[model samples]
Target chain A: MEFIFVLDILGVVAFSISGVLAAMRKGLDVFGILIIAFATSVGGGTLRDVLIDTDVSWLTNMTYVYVIIITTIFGIILRNKLNYLRKSLFLFDTLGIGLYTVVGVEKAISAGLPPVICVAFGTMSACFGGVIRDILCNDIPVIFHQEIYATACILGGFSYFALAYFNLPQDLIFIISGLIVIAIRISAVVFKISLPKVY
Target chain B: MEFIFVLDILGVVAFSISGVLAAMRKGLDVFGILIIAFATSVGGGTLRDVLIDTDVSWLTNMTYVYVIIITTIFGIILRNKLNYLRKSLFLFDTLGIGLYTVVGVEKAISAGLPPVICVAFGTMSACFGGVIRDILCNDIPVIFHQEIYATACILGGFSYFALAYFNLPQDLIFIISGLIVIAIRISAVVFKISLPKVY
Candidate 1:
């Protein structure tokens, strides 16, 4: 449980930095940058919680809020330095989504949602923050245009259920499912894999 | 109760039309048009419900979905005609926000939220659908840029509480509060009133 909590915080930090970078790239003011960062770090989980009628996770606990704030500040200060560390940032983002997919799937299952909806919610929880960020930035959401982002989460979600079906230990389920998501996402980027567009 | 139900449906239909028109104007495909219509009609109320931990309104009752579908089809078929009838559409949009504000305020009050938060929720329920529509269309939200949209809802929310404080009947409160919003919005359009930009 404690390990999952730590990973959750790491995810928030990773996503917050990504948001800050996007906002800075867009030349947004400090206030706009902060809002974007905050939204990107929490938007997915907030949407999931709302859909499932759970208390919004951040409102119930302030740790997420603190992490986003700290991340945004550091992200801005190190903006230039961070430009050279894109690969590292991408790794953190990959890990972030991997951990978040498992957390979202578990929450939906605990809420008694059907397996299909649970998997859908898992993908939503991992990707919707970036969706919100891109929308706020007035750009076509990257997920809609390109990238294997949501697909990775969906794959991870299926793996989670598969592992559970085999009666894998709960802790092992978390680690293995998260690794599946991370591996798929990282390989997609490294190998330049992308879904074909209809048009 | 029946009257509020009717008003709720009206609000949904009106916003759905607005969304369909926006999507068509952008030359989006049929699927994109329907998605935007659905989001614009339900996004605000969904946000309110989720924040307050209530069952999502549309998921619990299929009527909202039906209305959006029907509205979207007619809206598309009547797109050219609607351009000439912009005034009527504006009136419907105005009434929709007014009724939505009252509904949101009442729900928040029933849930025992603070008065200020209730008023904020009221405004959110009235405006955030359009916000979602704009975001989905990859544009800066109109509320943040131009117009007196959300301001009218905020004014109506305050009026609702003020009228209630004076011990007005519930029905009269609804009528008077809604009128205040409609009057403010229509006049803003008529006079071309808009919030000033800082930069």
Candidate 2:
């Protein structure tokens, strides 16, 4: 539980940094940067929660909100240093998506959604923040066409159900399923793995 | 109520046609066109419903879905004929925004949100579909910068509250406020009205 909590924070930080980077690339002002950062950090979860017809977490819980704001300010100040931290950021991003996918799947399962919908829920929760960011930045979503981004989360969703089917301990299942996503993303990036281009 | 229903269907058709134009401009295939059309038609209301934490209307109601699908087909078939119908399309679009704005505000009011947030909700419900369509087509949201588009919806929202404050009948307030949005948009376009450029 403590481990998941830490990963959740890491997910928020990773997403916030990504938002700051995208907004900066677009030359948005400080307010735009802040808005993008907030949206990116919470957009996916908020979307999933909305689909589940529940109160938005960020509206009710301010921990992630404060984290995103502080992170945005730090990212702006440290813009020059971002290049040096690329590797670390990539790792955090991978971990963030992995955790997000599992959490989304778990939420859907708890809500009694079907398996197909559960997998979709998991993938959207992990990826939709980037979708929102790219939309606001006026780009075709950067994450959508990338082979590994959605594919990794989707496979992570599959691994989750597989783990559950064998009746693995729930905690162990989550950690393992999340790790599978992280591993796939890392290995894909390291090896330059890609699916055949449809177009 | 029946008039509102007709206006709602008209809104869907207008939005679908706009989506088709956008997707066609981008040279997207038929599938892409269909997806974009559907998104444009329901994207805003779906977003509003999501924010209000309710079961999404389209998922529960098949009427809009069938309307969008049929509209997309006709939009494609009449692509060349659309040029002659530009005036009609513009009128429909204006009326669409007008009706959408009031409906959004009324929904927010029924949900018991604060007035300011309700106004924002109304504007978002009238505008975000275009935002989604543009994002998908890789353009800055076309509806956002247009002075009259959002301004009309916002003003309509204010009109709703103002009329209610004065103890107007609910139905009368809805009709009057919706007409205000339509009037604002039509006049703005006719007169070439514009907000001064920020940059």
Candidate 3:
């Protein structure tokens, strides 16, 4: 549990930096950049918590708030050096989504929601933060574009249910599910694979 | 209670149409238009419900979903003739914020949040749908721009608290608070009153 918590914080930090970079690319002010960073790090989990009728996770734990603040400042201070770290940041983001997907699925299952809704919730938890971030930045969400982002989460969600149905151990299920998400995302990016355009 | 329910439905319809119009202006497809309409109609209330840990209002009663469907179809069919009804649509939109603000404040009060949070929730309920709508359409929210939109809701929320403090009747408080919102919004538009740009 401690290990998962540490990974979660790392994910939040990675997403926060990603948001700061996006905001800086758009030349937003300091306040706007910080807000975007916060949204990118915690927006998806917040949305999932709300939908599931749970206390907002951040409100219950001040650690997430402090993490966002610290990350935003770190990201802004290191803006000039970010280009060199793009590959590392990308790896962290992929790992973050993997952890986020498992956490979302586990929460929904605990709430006794149906499997399909659980999967939906998991995908939403992993992807909606970026959706919110993109929206606030006045751009169409990248996930809604040709990217395989949400699709990777969805696949991992289905994998979670399949593994659980086979009576897999809980810890193994979490590890396998997270690995599947990371694998799919990395594969898609490396191969330049994307969903076909509808229009 | 029946009157409030009726007013709520009217507000939903008005916001749904507003969303459809916005999506159409952006040349979104049918699915995109309907999604925007749904978001604009129920997005605010859903946010409030989630934050307060209540069953989502729309999921409990299917009426909201049906209303969004009907409103979307109606809006798209009447799109060509909508230019002539801009003033009427604006009036409906204003009345919507009025009802929404009151409903949101009442709900937050029922949930036993602080008065400040209640007011914030009220303002969010009245205005966040449009904020979501604008984001989906790839624009900065109009309320965040120089518009007096959220300001009107904040004023109405404060008015509700003031009226309640005076020991006003429940119905009277609701009506007066709603009217305050409507009046402020209409006056702002008529007088070209707007917030000054900070940047």
Candidate 4:
């Protein structure tokens, strides 16, 4: 649990930096950049909590708020260095989504939702923060037409349920599920893979 | 209460029809159209309910589901005739926002939120459905750039609180706030008015 918490914080930091980068490219003011960072870091989890009728974590947890704010500050000051760090940023984002996918599925299970809904929640947890950020920035969500992002999260969720059914160690199932997401995303980007478009 | 219920149904119908039109123009398929219709009709209220930590109305109540489905069917079947009804369609859309602004303010009050937050909630409820619809269709939201739409809702919310402070009847306050929204929208369109952009 402590390990997962640390990964989650790392994910938030990576996502916040990405948000700042995107907002800066759009020429948004500092306030706008902060909001974009907020939306990117915690938007998915907030949506999942709302649907499951739980208290929104960021509203009660000051840690996320502080982390994102601090991250945005650093991202802005170090914007010039970010270009050199793209590869590492991508790695951090993949890890973040992997952890978030497992976290979302676990929360859904605790809420007593059905299997399909749990998988949907998992994907939502990992993907919708980017979706919300893209929407705020007036772009079509990358997952909708271009990336294999949500697919990786969905597959990881399926693996989690499958491992649990086989009576695997709970910690093993969690780690493997997250690792699968990370592996798939990294491979997709490296291989220039994408989802096929109907149009 | 019955009158409010009737108005709410009308608002749902109007928003759903608008959603259908937007999807049709975007060349979305039947399934896509239905999803857009659902989002535009209930997305704002759902966000509000989620933030307030209340039972999401559409999840528990079948009325909204039935209303949007029926509205979409009619909207698709009568798309050609819809052009002739542009004036009436705009009227319906305006009325819908007016009702939603008041409904959102009322809900925030019930949740015991502060006045400024209530106004923000009111504007969000009146605008975010269309915002979501536009985002899904990959367009910048109209309210974000050119329209005075959200401003009307915010002002109406302020009016709601002001009237309440004066010890006006609850029903009167509700009706007046809604009327203010409708009037502002109509006047804006009639005079070709717009919100000034910083750029």
Candidate 5:
């Protein structure tokens, strides 16, 4: 339970940083940066909650919002030292994808959805914010244009269910599933792994 | 029915023109222009359909996609020559809001949603695409940032229901309701009408 909480915070921070980086790249105003950060951190989860008729997670917990705002201010204040920030942002984003995919799948399962739908929802919860950020920045979503993004989350989700079916310990299942996603994403970046473009 | 079909087609063309002009202003490539045009034309309705769990209207009608593509290509080819595109784009956007507000309201009412929800659904259907467009451009959504954008759609929707209650001629009610939205939007733009900014 405590580990879940920690992972949730990491996920929020990761998403917020990614949003901030995208906003900085666009040279948006401070307010715009905050707005984008907030949206990126909460948008996917909010959409998921709304779709499933659940209370909005961020709205119910002020800590998530506070963390994002604090991180945004910190990122802005340290804007000149961006290289380190970029690396951290990528790591955090990948971790968030794993954590969020787990939570989203669990939430859907609790809501009585089928396994396939749960996996789809899980992947959506992990990746839709980045898609929204890219769309808002007038760029094709990285997931659609580049190496495995949602694909990693989706595969991780399926792996999680498979592991659970085999009676793997819950903690080990989570750790292994998350590591798989991170490994896939990192290797994709390192080796330029990408799907064949249809068009 | 024929009149309704014509109005729907006109709305698509008008919205597509508005999207093309917006993309041209951004100096996007042909692919971007086509994407923006299609999104602008169908985005709101698609959102409405998704939210209501109905079949996506435009997917069933490939003509919508074809129309947007043709319009986008035309806009790109005539980019340098279309000095009056700005004025024309505004006109079409206004018409789009008017036509779509009615379409959305009718659909919602037919679906047995309460009146207030119907109004919200109608306004959302009219404005979501432009909001999406602004977001994609890495700008605050114009609907959220300034002007009486969604307000005009709401007012037009109210007029529609009111006219229906008064047993007005169905066809005349359509024209009157749509004209009201156009007038409101035009006035808002010309007079800089907007809600008070939140602090």
Candidate 6:
């Protein structure tokens, strides 16, 4: 439980960083940056809670909101000193995707959802934040155009449940699943991998 | 039940018109207009349903999708002739808010939710589409900054339940509530009225 909490915080911070970078790149004001950061940090969990008929996660936990604010401030203050915001932002985004996907799967399983729905929720939780961020920034979401984003989350979710069925330790399962998502996302970005356009 | 079916179609067309106008102002291509129109027409209802643990309204009704596409095509073909796009867009937007607020309230009431939550759902259904549209267009949501936007929906919802509780005739209640919403919205825009900023 404690380990999960730590990972959740890390995920939130990573998402916030990515969101701030996206907003800053668009030259949005402080309010806009804060809004994007908050949305990316908690958007996935909020969507999951709403779908599962629960109170919103961030509303119930003010700590998440505070974390987003602090992280946004940090990013704004250090942006001038940072030499490569793009690369760092990409790394943080990948980390966020992996962490949120696993946490989403865990939450869905706890709610007694079917495996397929759990995987769907995991992918949605991992990617929908970036979708909103891109939309708000007036850009096409990179996930829709550039890489195998949601597919990585789906793959990780399948691996997670498969390992669970094999009686793997829970922590090990989470670590392995998260690593798979991160690896797939990084490889996809580096190798110019993407889904074919239906049209 | 038949009345609801008819009203649902009307509401879809009304929302789609506003969406098309907004997208046209941006000079979007056909695909972009379709996406924007679809989001504007159904985004609020989708959010409301997801929050209430119901399936998204459009995913079950292909007619809504058709209506949006048809509206987008119509808007594109007649763009140059539609000098009154701004006026017509406002009218359609107001009508949509009136109809959707009542529908949202009715759905929540049918689900046996408390009155306050029903009111909230009504306002949410009436406003979230514009919120999404603005986010996607890289503008601050009009509701967050301008006119008596969400206030009109809330008032209309109150009028609806108030009349129903007093055993008013069904048609009279619906018409009166909807007219109230339209009146408030139109008046606010014409008079350049807005809620005072809190900050």
Candidate 4 residue-wise lDDT, A39-92, digit = tens:
899889989998898877775456888899899888888888999988878888
Q: Please state the error at residue B192 of candidate 2 in Å.
A: 3.0
Distance from true location, Cα of B187 in model 5, Å: 31
Those runs of model 3 whose alpha carbons end farther than 4 Å from true positions after fitting are: B1-45, B48-53, B57-131, B139-199
- The per-residue C-alpha lDDT of model 6 at residue B171 equals 84
TM-score for candidate 3, please give it: 0.61
Q: What is candidate 5's CA lDDT for residue A47?
A: 68
Interface RMSD of 1: 5.1
TM-score of chain A of 2: 0.97
Pairs with backbone N, CA or C atoms under 3 Å apart (clashes), candidate 3: none
Residue-level lDDT of model 1, residues B72-180, one tens digit each, is 8888777778878777778778889999999899999999998899999999999999999988878788899788889999999999999999999999998999889
TM-score of each: 0.61, 0.61, 0.61, 0.61, 0.58, 0.57
The alpha-carbon deviation from the true structure for residue B2 of candidate 4, after best TM-score superposition, in angstroms, is 3.5
Q: Which stretches of candidate 5 lie over 4 Å from their true place?
A: B1-46, B49-107, B110-199
Report the candidate with higher lDDT, 4 versus 6. Answer: 4
Regions of candidate 6 where Cα sits further than 4 Å from its true position = A1-6, A60-62, A85-89, B1-45, B50-109, B112-199
Angstrom error at residue A192, model 6? 1.7
- Stretches of candidate 2 off by over 4 Å are A1-45, A51-53, A57-131, A140-199, B195-199
DockQ for every model comes to: 0.14, 0.14, 0.16, 0.13, 0.07, 0.10
Ten-residue stretch with the least lDDT total in model 4 chain B? B190-199
Candidate 2 lDDT, tens digit per residue, A61-166? 5688679989988999899898998988888889999999998998999999998889899999999999988889888887766657889999999999999999
Which 10 consecutive residues of model 5 chain B have the lowest summed lDDT? Answer: B26-35
Per-candidate Cα lDDT values, in order, are 0.86, 0.85, 0.86, 0.86, 0.78, 0.78
DockQ of candidate 3, scored on C-alphas against the true complex (2 decimals): 0.16
Q: Which of candidates 3 and 6 reaches a greater DockQ?
A: 3
Off by over 4 Å in 4: A1-45, A48-53, A57-131, A140-199
> How do the residues A6-70 of candidate 1 rate in per-residue lDDT, one tens digit apiece?
77887888899988988988999999999999999999999888798778978978898889998
Instruction: In model 1, state the lDDT of residue A102.
Output: 91
